[model samples]
Every structure is written in structure tokens, then in C-alpha cells.
Target chain A: MSPRPETAAGPAQGRPRVKRFARAEHRVHRATAALMAVCVATAACLYLPFLAQLVGRRALMVTLHEWSGILLPVPLLLGLASRALRADLTRLNRFGPHDRRWLRSVLRRRGGRPAGKFNAGQKLYAAWLAGAVLVMTGTGLLMWFTHLAPLVWRTGATFVHDWLALSLLIVIGGHIWMAYRDPESRAGLRTGSVDAAWARREHPLWTPEDGKGGRGEEE
Target chain B: MTKDENPARPAGHDDDRRGTPVGRRVVLGMLAAGAAGVAAAPYLQRAYDETLGAAAQNDPTGLSGLLPAGGGFRYYSVTGSVPDKDEHSYRLTVDGLVRHRASYRLADLRALPQTRLVRDVQCVTGWRVPHTAFEGVRLATLLDAAGVRPEAKAVRFTCFDGAYSESLTLEQARRHDVLIALRMQDRPLGHDHGGPVRLYVAPMYFYKSAKWLSGITVTDHVQPGYWEQLGYDVDAWVGRSNGRDDVPTT
Candidate 1:
């Protein structure tokens, strides 16, 4: 294959492009990812025995983990200010007949329906992650400020926080794997745009007759 | 034959007043639960002990400290490593704002009028070991012997580990519950437990009961302890402070 285009900006020898995400959306995604990475890395150092021993700044690690977890939702909250992100979030929230067909097709390992800006799987993942992050933050706060709740509640919070964190790591791993398998999707996230032909093939419902993807473009 | 002879006795009096026996299913279920608990006991205990050990050494993940271990107590060392001090090498000094500054060897402390206090040891992080017996000379006794000057307002504690420090108001320091602890659980304190001498502030959070304790200095004012300096409440009275509602240990 010829060298892949670095960005979906200009048509490379006649390849048209469609904007998939606004700049504000991209910043929100990046900031959230960075904070999540910090939370996960610090959590590993704090929880895993070998890593804890090897790293050995227990108190500092505790502070970092707590702060990062607390800040994990800030970017998404701020992103609501961007009209483009808000519209996309609305789209991601609604499920149509096509999305149900898409889900059935994935389960059967066969092609069935065209996807919109986000597929059924993507919508489910987004919703699951949003709920997970909120729960994690809630439990994290309970654990951090032990005085806020009773001993039983605090104990339950710790248990939920730990198991939920493990689940989140696994789910995030799957997300990364899927992203790696789809370069167009990665490009859409990284450059805020994607090839029109690729969008038509993968998300035909989102690509209008003008070859411009709707909902995610800056208003 | 005995039943035949005692005809006046009620039939089934040996069984139950209602003449009903416990259900076999219920008994079996209870037996199974007990058996499962017995079978799982070792693993649970091992996990608890190992977690406590890991925390004591260095718990970077901070989560291990939150675990309610089997032993009721967990070790925590801020400096990661503290050199062991035995009776021969141990020395505790009472100085600062005092008319007669003095240093006591471990033997001298043990020879003094020893008072034993049994109370729950509470960590501000929320684990508690109930009814822990701490034996040593009362800190007030030392302050009295040292002849603390009228200018003294607080007592600052320094540890041999060279990193941890704690302070208490002079009034708090004089509480009968406060001790320059030498023994714990009726045995000589272990290195992991901050032996041969450690400060035990009975009513305060365990952090105020500084480990590897080496010095008691009468100071002009309260200087916050190690954890306090790191944002923990300076006056960490179990239920009264730290916004926690734990029942007062005292």
C-alpha cells in the first residue's frame, strides 16, 4: 500500500474527507484519556505489591491517584459547552432500528445494517464507561474521605471501587484493541476527521449526500 | 427399662418441650456453612496477614491499609525502613523547656513505676485493634521528673527513624492514658510495632502515637505530626475529630 495519509484534511489525489469530531471534542477526549491514564498508573503503583515495593512513594502515589480520579470527569463536563460535542452526545444516547440491526449483525458475525456516527457497540461502550467513571469517582471519594459514610458503606465502596476498576481496565483494553483494528476510527479521533469513502462504508447513516458527516462538525 | 419404671415422666421430655426435633436440612446447612468457614479460614488469614505485612513495609497503593486484617492491627512506617533498636541501644530523652533534661536507657524506663493501659488502638484511616494493652511509664511522670518549665506549652515527639514526628498540647500530654510505651500485648514491643520504646497516645489516632519514638521535647507550641503535616487533622481524636463518627475508643 502507498504511504497512508497522516490526516483527513485535504483530498490526497482525489480522496474527499468528512469532519468527524470538532477540536473541542478532540481536546475533551485527550484530556479525559490523560487523566484516566494517570489514575490507572498511580493505582497500579498503589495496589500491586511488586510495583508498590519497586516504586516506594506510597503517600505521594495515594495523593496522585485520589486527585486524578477526582478530576477524571472534568473534561467531559467542560466538553458539554461545545455544541458539536453536545449534539454528538445526543446522537450517541439515542438508539434507532438500524442500531439494533447492527447489534444483531455483530452477534451473528454477518453484515446487516449501516451504522450512524457511532455504532450500537460504540454507544453501549460510551454509556457503560460514563456510568463506570461516575461510580468509580463516587466510590473513590467515599474511600478518600472515610468520614463521609458509615464503616459498612465505606467497606462496600472499597470493594466496588476495586472490582469496578478491574472491569474498567478490561473494557478499556477491548476498546483499544478495536481502535487498533480500525485505522479510520483512530484517524477520526486523532485528526477530528475521516475519509468520506471510509465514512460511507462504515457509518453511511452519518455521511450525508454532500459527503459531510453531520452532528460532529463545529456549529 | 428405666422408662418403663418411670411411667410418670412425660413422653418426649428429652426431645423438646414441643416434642419437635430440629430439621435435618437446617442442621446440614449450618454444618456446611461452618465447614466452609473452617476451610476458608487459613486462606483468609494468610491474605490478611500478607496485606498487613505489605502495608507495613511500603503500601504505595494505599488500598492495602484500608483492608480489615485478621490481626486487628496493621504496621505502617512512613520512612519505608527503620533501623531496629534493641534494649541495649535504645535511649529516650526528655529535653527542651525543661529545668532538668535527662536521657533514660531502656532499663531505666522499665525500672520506673510502670502503668498498663488497655484501650483500642485506632488508626485515622479507620482500622481499629480493640483492647490493646500498652505498658510503660506515663509520659506525665517523665514530664514531672524533667521538671517542665512554665514556658512549655506542648510536647513534640521525634522518632529514631528520623522522618516521623508528632506533637500534643501539654495538657493532652499529661493525660494518664499517654505513655512512653515499652511493651504491647503484654510482650516486649517488636520492631515492626515500634519497640523498644514508642509513644502511645491512647485517646488520639495511632499516628499521634508515633513509632520508633526517641525524643520528648517540651515546646512552646504544638507542632503537627507527620500525617498532620500531610493534611490529616492535627487533633485526631477518634470520634471527635477527622469528621469521623467512630465510637470513642477511650
Candidate 2:
């Protein structure tokens, strides 16, 4: 072997550049993250004061919060127009035997098994975040169009909307923590590619051959 | 399911072996969350009530305008100061395009048949005070008493607050739910609550039922109220206008 690229898994230098996430996958992730940051910030600004009884339903702040929340899913829907993202979604849906081994390694604080494009934890988190976004939108509409739902749904929506907001904050915090700890992972997210040696070492079971993914055969 | 019961299990496979700890963590997390939710329930209810309680008797902060008030009410005066009218000095004038222009004293209006109605008072800003009772003479009763002219198509309202004004179609003005309210919540209207007399359009948002009501002018067309001039709808029907379908308070 000539040399291996310096990856978070280890320090050897020069490996082939292999695409990990497609351009569309990177764009979707980046845009969604940026939008969610603003949404969360606006929510914090609007909600904290009301909780503290510092202000009532302020029109300007409330309008910003409402519109930002309503528009959050736009990027996700627009992102789906990319076939690469659609393919990524299909890949993210399936959990294989390697995923179970990866989870076990995570629990044991050791990298026992290498993962494919997405590990089990990542897949679970994506699924959870998608569900959360749906819940937020549904509840938000109920609150906005108050008379559109019955009293029970209105009240229930308020309760769920608030609690889920807290949970989402926690989930996002975890994501940031994981990204901060792994610079190579962050780099791959930025460039949409990883060193081939790093890919083999980090995701041993699913390395693509000359950029053609060996997905079904390996699984 | 014991690990040994399945003959296909690989000798050193750890996949199923490690699931126990992870599953235990998930169960424990759920239990903790449930406990926290239960413990926080009462505080949530109390906090909600305090933060969004009924409008204060004399809300100086004006926060009430933007909050729901269950069985509460708010005091808003466009003129900054409310003009007071007692039994001896109060007058409500019905004029312009009317065959019979009329004025009545507080006691004189009180002498008319009083109609009591309990309706939800909805503000355009999204606050609602439910089941609020208003007792007074009906607008139609007064219009009938004054004799509305056939050519009159709208009824314009002017308030003692001076700056605020509202109007409704003659037909809307004649709705059974509309009242020239003399009392609210079983008490004579206090000045803060637009006492002496106020217009109460039961099926419309509260602003259309102008506070400190002073004038009911019959006109050829509708004149937008103070808020309407600032972009509120001229026809502020409950659960209908203001670009929202809030549950009808009535």
C-alpha cells in the first residue's frame, strides 16, 4: 500500500477519494441544519419571555416564530427533487446485521464493526428527527388555525408541541456533540467524500469498488 | 427467549447478547421521562394560568390584549382617557339618514326591555373571554323605536373614547344578538368596562361592539372602525373574519 489518508480513525496519510454522501445529501443536511438553528433560536426568543411573563403574545416575534416554523419543511420538500437525496433516503431506511454490531460497539465504547453510509444510530436519529418535524408541523397548524380542530385537539397539540420542542433541542445538542468529536466526519459532511482507505477502515463491510457501491451483494 | 434455544445462533455472535443493556437504558429513560412529566404537570397548569390569566381589573400593562382570558375582559380606550357618563348626564344619539333622530338618557335607555345574553367575547388578536353576560336594550329595539329609514343601509357607531369608530350593515345591526349593553357580568358597567352604556354585538369580535359607545348613525355605507382603519375587517364576525377561524365565542 502506498499510504493512507489521515482520518479520525487513525493517522496514516494518502487514500483514494471515494464519495460518501452525494452532493444533494450534503446540501439537504446543511440547509436543514441552518434552517433548524434559526427556527430554534426564534422559538427560544418568543417562548422564554412568555414563560417568564415578561411579555404577552407579541405580534412581531410571534409572527416570526409562526412563519419560520411553517416554512421549515419547505427545504426538506425542495431537497427531495434531487434523485441522489431520494436514493440516500432509501439507503437510510434499511438496517442490516452490520448495524446491530455497530450499535453494540458504540455501547461497548469500541469500534468493533464498521458501518455503511449510515450507522444504526444515525439512521435512528434521522427517523426520529423526521417524525419530530411532522409532529411539530401538525401541532403548529392546529394552534394557528384554532377553530379548525376541536378543543381537545387544540389543547393536546399545545402540550405535545411544547414538549417535543424540548426533546428536539436535546437531540440537536447530541448531534453537535458527535460532530464536534469527529473532525473527519465533519470534513466528509462538508466535501461529500472520504478517503477510500478511511472509508474501508471506518465502513469495512460496504466500501464501494471504483465509486460503484457494492450495496446489495455485500448485504 | 434464551440465547441457547436457537440452534442457528453463531457461537461467538454478540449482536443479541448486547441488546439487554441498551433495551434496559431505553426502558429506564422512558420511565424517567414519564416521572418528570407527571411531576411537572401541576406546575405546567399553574404556570399557564398565571402567565395567561384573565385580564386584570385595570390592566395597566395592556398584556391582556394578546392573551386568552377564559371568563375575563379587557379595558382599552383609544382616547387614552375614558369619558364618563352618569345617569343624569349620559346620552346616546341616533341620527343621520334616520327618519327619527333620537337621544336617550341613561335611565331612559334602562327603562326599555333589557335583553340579557351570554356570549364569548373574542378579540381579533386571539384572546377570548367566554360566556360573558351583557344585559341591555337591543340595537334593533332602539332602531325600531327610532324608526330606521328605508334608505338607510348601514349603522355607524362612534364611541365616547372619541378616537374609535365602528359600522355594520343595517341587517347586521338588527341581529338578535346585538345589544346596547348597560351592564356586564351582572354588574352595572364600570367606567373601565365602558360603563353607563356600550354596544355589544354578540356574534362579532369584541371590537365591533365598541366600548364607550355614544353614537349610532344610520348611513348609506359602512365606515370602518378605528382598528378597521388600521387593517381590521369591517365585518368582524366571530369565527368568520380577521383571516382566522377561531372557535365562535357565542
Candidate 3:
């Protein structure tokens, strides 16, 4: 048989096509996730020990937390430089009509609607995390550069930063649990690819496309 | 006030009570050790200050402020060591842009009517010592005695440590709460606590109250303090500067 054409078309006339996340998208996702994990872990280490004085290691921990928060945006900023990543960002920004249905279905313990590359829940999570990171960065900077803001602003920033930090912890926990329950979803993040059947089952609306996350040519 | 003419007696007096007869070599060794201890005390205190500050910094939660002010209070000196001054050597000079240039010894300051203020001592770094009683001659009295020049807009402070400096506008300097604090917590101010004389700007962050105060210079304009030069606010009203309003310490 002739060598299978290296295209999104198909392996043959009868074979099912396998769509996968683009390599760039996968790389950006993994890098962003890793950066976020580092930031969250550092923040946790610094804040979880409520009695830092008793621990007698507060200065080092604070410095670490400060630096990690300052650097949190770097990975995503770099990833946004990728055309593919930017497109993904746009997709994540818009919550579709199906998203509410998908959320309702998830709550009902049943699949409600087909999703694209990302479901409504995933999009909302990404959006929320992005917003949270922005808030954290703004408030953290205000706290770090003491003279940058007035006392009232600083006080407000501190209160908001602390509350948001706790909220992010909870949100991240739920996200991890969801990922844990779905091996294929985790595989998509890990290897940048998922089986066509898994993708179809989970995200029924996601279609194999030329440039978007979809079927790749047979190796 | 008794002059400490025999400074060496106190430095190594504890070591001398070991009960051995003073041999020639032992005497020389005792004198040498006393001199070294005196020289090293300030630096040793500075190290202790650094250790405490480091501990506070290491705490990410900033709960270290709740920790006992480490041996009653935090001790910090910009200069590693400052020479001790007794009554005879200590002089607080009020000069520069003043009509009446006055110099005060510790005795002269003590003779002046003392005003007591009980206010919270708040560090810009977030630690606070609450309701610290500081008794001293009113800075207003000293300024009135000096007759501040009409052109003077601010008061500049210089510390005996020769490094730390602070400033306040003439208006701020004259607030009733402000004092040339000579005593802290009912005791004569210890050297560790900016003894003999320290500016106590009760309403402002502690940094505004320059420690080891030696000179009060009336300047035509406000002068940025030691910490102010390094990004701290010139007017560090408690709960206002350093991007924190933990609570009004005062």
C-alpha cells in the first residue's frame, strides 16, 4: 500500500481519525500549569504556616513567596506569544451557551452538551485563574512596594490578596480532583494528545480540524 | 547624674569577681578583655538585632510581630556600634536656623519639666509595642527656648550613632505628643533604647523618632530621614506609610 498521506484527512477511507491538541498548545498548557503550581506551592508554604514566628523562618519564606508571585505571570505571558496559544486564549475567554448546560449536566452527574476543545467549565476555570492571577499580582506588588500606594489602598489590597489566595486554593483543588477522575483529560495535558474516542465522548462538539486541536496525519 | 569616669569598671567587672588575686599578667589581660568587650558590645547588639530582624523576615505570615518583641523590644542600630555617653560627655545641641542656639546636658534636660506620653510604638515593619510610656522634656519647650528662626520649616535630627537621621516639619515637631524622650517605661532610657535622648514622635511610625538623638537642626525645609532616603516616607504617620494599616499603634 502507498504511504499514508501526512495530512489531517485520514489514515484510510474506513479508519477513524484521531484528533489531538497541537504540540504548541500542549507545551504552553504544561508550562503555564507548571508555573502556576510553583506559584501556588510557594504561596502555600509561606501562608500555611500561620505561626511563622514560631517556625523562626519567616523572612526566607516571605521572600520566596514574593518572588514566586512576581514571576507567576511570566510563563503565561511567554506562552501567549505563540499564535496557537493566543487563539486558545481567545477561545477560553468566551463562554458559550452550551457552557451553562455542560455545568448543569456535570452537577447532575451526566453529560449535558457537547463541547469544543474545552468545555464551558474548563473555560470558566481558566478565566477565573487568569483573573485571580491578575488580582494577586496587583495586590502583591502594592504590598511589596510599600510606597506605591496609600495606606487605605494597601490595606484593601492585603485583605483582597489574602481572601483570594484562599479561594484560589479551593478552586485549584477542585480542578485537580476533576483531572484525577478523567485519565484522558490528564493525558491531554501531559502528552498533548488524547484518543479520538475519549475526545468525542467527553467533548462531543470538538471537531477534527486543520489548524485547531484535531486529527493529525498518521506517522 | 554621676559621671562614669571609670568606664572600664563596668565592662569587665563581672569577670573580675572570679576571686583570684590580680597578678600583673591577669591585670593586663583583664584590662584588654574589658576594652574588647566594650568595643564589641554595640556590634554584638547589632548582630542580635540582625538575627531578630532575619527571623521576622523569614516568617511569611508576618505573625512574628506577635512574638515577644524579643527580650522586651527590638534593638536595631544603623551603625554597628555607637560609643556610650555618660552625663558629662552627653550633649543635645539645638542649632541651625535658630535664634537661640542652646546646648543641653543630661542634667539640664532632666531639670526641665518632664512630660509623659503613653503611646504604642509601631515599627514600619509591622511590629508594635503597645502603650509604651515615654517621659521626656517637651520638644516644644526646647524649640521655644531655642527660638526657632522664622525661616525654619522643619527640624532635622542627628543620632549619636552618627548614621541614623530623621526629620519632621516644624509643625509636626511641635505636636504635644512629640517629646525629647529621656526615659522609657518609667526607667531612664537604656542605651539599647536610644538612651540619654531620643526623639519620640508618638503619632508617627517609630522611625520618625530618631534613636540616639544628639542634634536637632532647624532647617529651611524638610529633610528625608535615614530610612526615608531608602524609600520610607518622610512623613510616616502610623497606619499610613509602608503600605500597611495593621492597626494604629498609637
Range of the 10 consecutive residues with the lowest summed lDDT in candidate 1 chain B = B13-22
**Model 3 Cα lDDT, one tens digit per residue, B25-134:** 33344334433433454464457557974676567766664332332355555554577888999999999999889889999999999999998888775446667899
**TM-score of the second chain in each model?**
0.73, 0.73, 0.72
Please, what are the lDDT tens digits per residue for candidate 2 over residues B46-78? 576665553443477755433323225444444
* C-alpha lDDT (0 to 100) for residue A71 of candidate 2: 79
Span of ten consecutive residues with least summed lDDT in model 3 chain A: A49-58
Q: Which one wins by DockQ: 2 or 3?
A: 2
Comparing 1 and 3 on TM-score, the stronger one:
1
Model 1 regions more than 4 Å off:
A1-19, A42-70, A81-83, A101-114, A135-184, A193-219, B1-91, B103-120, B129-153, B160-163, B174-197, B229-235
**Model 3, B32: alpha-carbon shift in Å?**
69
Model 3 residue B31 CA deviation (Å) reads 69
lDDT of 3 by residue, A46-159 (tens): 444332212323345566678777877777776655655654555555455566677788789986565766776777677667667766777788778877866655555655
lDDT per residue, candidate 1, B46-111, as tens digits? 565566644543666555543334234655656556788887888899999999999999999989
Top of the candidates by DockQ:
2
What is every candidate's C-alpha DockQ against the true complex, given to 2 decimals? Answer: 0.02, 0.05, 0.01
